[model samples]
Target: MAKEMQKTSMFIERNPGDCENGDICKNLDDDGRVKRTGTWVTASAHIITAVIGSGVLSLAWAIAQLGWVAGPAVLMAFSFITYFTSTLLADCYRAPDPVHGKRNYTYMDVVRAYLGGRKVQLCGLAQYVNLLGVTIGYTITASISMVAVKRSNCFHKHGHHVKCQTSNNPFMVIFACIQIVLSQIPNFHNLSWLSIIAAIMSFAYSSIGLGLSIAKVAGGEHARTTLTGVTVGVDVSGSEKIWRTFQAIGDIAFAYAYSTVLVEIQDTIKSSPPENKSMKRATTLGVSTTTIFYVLCGLVGYAAFGNEAPGNFLTGFGFYEPFWLIDFANICIAIHLIGAYQVFAQPLFGFI
Candidate 1:
């Protein structure tokens, strides 16, 4: 409360004669003007990096289970929802000038402003839990991608159980080490170049997946038909089917979930130009780019592997013709996940 009053008083005495320590008070302009300095393109890249992570790799499997019709529909719905909620986060950057004309640097701040202290605590809890899950998810995805890249063959006899003895622990430890260093970079704004690289990495792997699918189909080595029915409104049979469909929906939702870090990304976009619109533009571009990739990857992957699609697309769809591409895509995924870990972990670090 005292800190809030001091800030309020500082803004009030922003005038020349009101402050005895005029230099210090003036330096404490501490308004949106100074906070908003990031370039829109860079901000868009960060947001893109945040949205497109390991989730995209599994998107194909979800589509396969849900079939073409429902899969695309779910992806579109999440695209719209994620985009809308993200813009709402950008708008929360500056509360009404009367309250606090400064920028909100994190999602927790926004929740605290609108919902109060308890909600802020809940948001922090949720944020950390979400980050922890993302870290684990990324770790698992990276390990699987690496394992897939190194596999000599999958020609083992069925019903003859062979102990693969795979442990993702080493891979996870390597990334955890990377994050321990990257996370110390101090802030999101500093990651502009890295974010751009991560964004391009996302596009590269996604395009590779799509291109491989198309190539397989052209070579007559892939199936274009769905493993499950795609008829709209066709009622699924039994409780098991319904439950599986619901699980697919949850998967799609999880794929598009990035609201936890929206505010933090927005903080990097400048408000200098009073009516700063960079944040909204960044969110739009990021969501639009990811949605496009999601659609193409899902549709093409399902067509390539049919219902045989594995939960991890990189490992499931093995295009051995020019196998170097597989290695490149998996490497890119690992690189992208590193940046993604920083994106989520940075905000959680601040909250701590």
Candidate 2:
């Protein structure tokens, strides 16, 4: 019986594209689809791209308007707020079973589940509004920064804001549109390397500009007046007692305003495997990195200017000067923001 065993054996072999049920699995074959493998660095890069954008550049302006201590405090406060929102989403949201599986309920799903349909619609609309405002702000800031870099113009040449020239210069619109279009193209795979390079460029650029600002301020015979009065709009009027009280709360508002993305980030990481500790670790590192960077930029900008008022930091400190790196940073930021817009817009697109 042992000698005859090989004569009775039958073997079944499956091809690479075959399924266990003996079906040819064509579902994965050239369906205009691509798959990407993401490790910790890729995940971190994506999250960082979400968090750090055109907003960081405006930190100096916001903090200047609010106060010096208010800037870094805002960053820390926003970080925690975002973290808490993310945690809440992780605990409350649930996905349907695979047998009748639906795409997992996103943050919008949780909002709709808790708040109902009408509120969800309203919230979605509000998010679009926020996105629009954010986009416009970024585009304007980037274009202006581009001008400042290329023309060696003043950072805040109030008489000739760079955005004002766009109507006459068709090339600027063409370039901006091209950048926007490039951002919209789906090439999510293999972008981890691109993001890593961008992040490095961001750090290097900020470091050099910040260093120069610090040096000039240190050697200063104080070219600009050290700001004292809390200016409202363009007015240099002294801060009123009531306004000063309000200014104390300014950082909290700014911090919370930017905390909205935390929900999206939380949903993303929570979708990963339970055993994968790296997602959480990456998130923590990303938030910490952003916090440290913002704090350093804010503190240095404030100290160099010697003012508690936010605007004072920019002008009084002379630290917001046009550096070559700002141009590069703006482009990187625009690209990074395009990724973010894609992520945020996908759910809405699906619902529509």
Instruction: Give the local distance difference test score of model 1.
Output: 0.72
- What TM-score goes with each of the models? 0.83, 0.65
- lDDT by residue for model 1 (77-114), tens: 99999988877667777775512466566787777776
Model 1 residue 328 CA deviation (Å) reads 1.0
* CA error at residue 113 for candidate 1, angstroms: 0.9
| Model 2 TM | 0.65
Per model, state how many residue pairs clash.
3, 5
lDDT of 2 by residue, 225-335 (tens): 224323554434445534653553453344334334433433333234431344556666776777776666655555554334243222122334453344454455445
Off by over 4 Å in 1: 1-36, 97-100, 152-166, 222-240, 274-276
- Cα deviation at 120, candidate 2, in Å, is 1.9
